[model samples]
Target: MNRRTDETRPARSKGREEALDHFVATVAKIDEVLGAIKAANDEHYGTHPDEVHWGHAGDAGRVLAGLKEVLDIIEGE
Candidate 1:
């Protein structure tokens, strides 16, 4: 008995292939951004402790919150 499912099915249209390709590319871009963020974080945002300010803290806080929201959605929270 053969059962067809998402894994066994092929993309059947040019538009679908394009959409899947775009989704894959967008995920790749997100991965690249995460890598950059990690590197910057390791460098302490390229600043001395005394040089850090409220504006920088706010920027980092916003990014952190955005990432948390994405995680929450993905985790079905």
Candidate 2:
């Protein structure tokens, strides 16, 4: 089955565009937050990250992996 783009579709609810817009905005926000986190991580841990400084690498890795999955879905890929 073929699906038309929003521009070709008749007038309807704004949900699709709104969702896409939200996704774009959310991605930007995520980038901003992640940037700050990386900055803090680099500042505190320097080159070698220890278990004591910054965060537990394993925990952060798990959370980031989950977030990447969700983001991939939201990005339609």
Candidate 3:
């Protein structure tokens, strides 16, 4: 058999492919959970804090949106 060249690596194994599939599924599950959380928060609108407006929670949607974008790039979707 011919040896591998310096520029060419061996083909990926099935195990690696399976692991990648699992990773994609896991990320998707996380996205689902975040969606649920956002929905729940949207449904109730939550109680007001003492003095401050608790602006951080207001940004959850934007934060999750950024994370989804990152995951999209990671999964090449």
Candidate 4:
């Protein structure tokens, strides 16, 4: 159908602009999180042989599961 007219174009463009701004902010936040994860990994944040325990494993498992879900969505899986 020919429902969209010139009048709607500006509204759609503004919506797109707002969506893109949100997307950029989200990506920046994700990047910041990834950097934090990398730093934690580099420092072995909770993996010390004497300090590690079942709780650490559980925490890692949950983090991995969450990351896997994000990766699956990013991969269009």
Residue pairs with colliding backbones in model 2 are none
**Candidate 2 segments exceeding 4 Å error:** 1-13, 45-77
lDDT (tens digit, per residue) of candidate 4 on 2-68: 6898999999999999999999999999999999998987877757779988998888888889999
Candidate 1 residue pairs in clash (backbone atoms < 3 Å): none
Which candidate model has the greater lDDT, 3 or 4?
Answer: 4
**Per-candidate TM-score against the hidden true structure:** 0.68, 0.45, 0.41, 0.85
The better-scoring model by lDDT among 2 and 4 is 4
Top model number, TM-score: 4
- State the lDDT of candidate 2 residue by residue for 14-56, as single tens digits: 7687888999999899899889878966675344444344456
What is the C-alpha local distance difference test score of each model? 0.88, 0.73, 0.73, 0.90
Write one digit per residue (lDDT tens) for candidate 3, span 14-71: 6687899999999899889889878867854454555336475657667679879988
Off-target runs (Cα >4 Å) in candidate 1 are 1-12
Please give the range of 10 consecutive residues that has the lowest summed lDDT in model 4: 40-49
Q: Residue 6 deviation, candidate 3, in Å? A: 15
Comparing 1 and 4 on TM-score, the stronger one: 4
Ranking by TM-score: 4, 1, 2, 3
lDDT of 4 at 69: 99
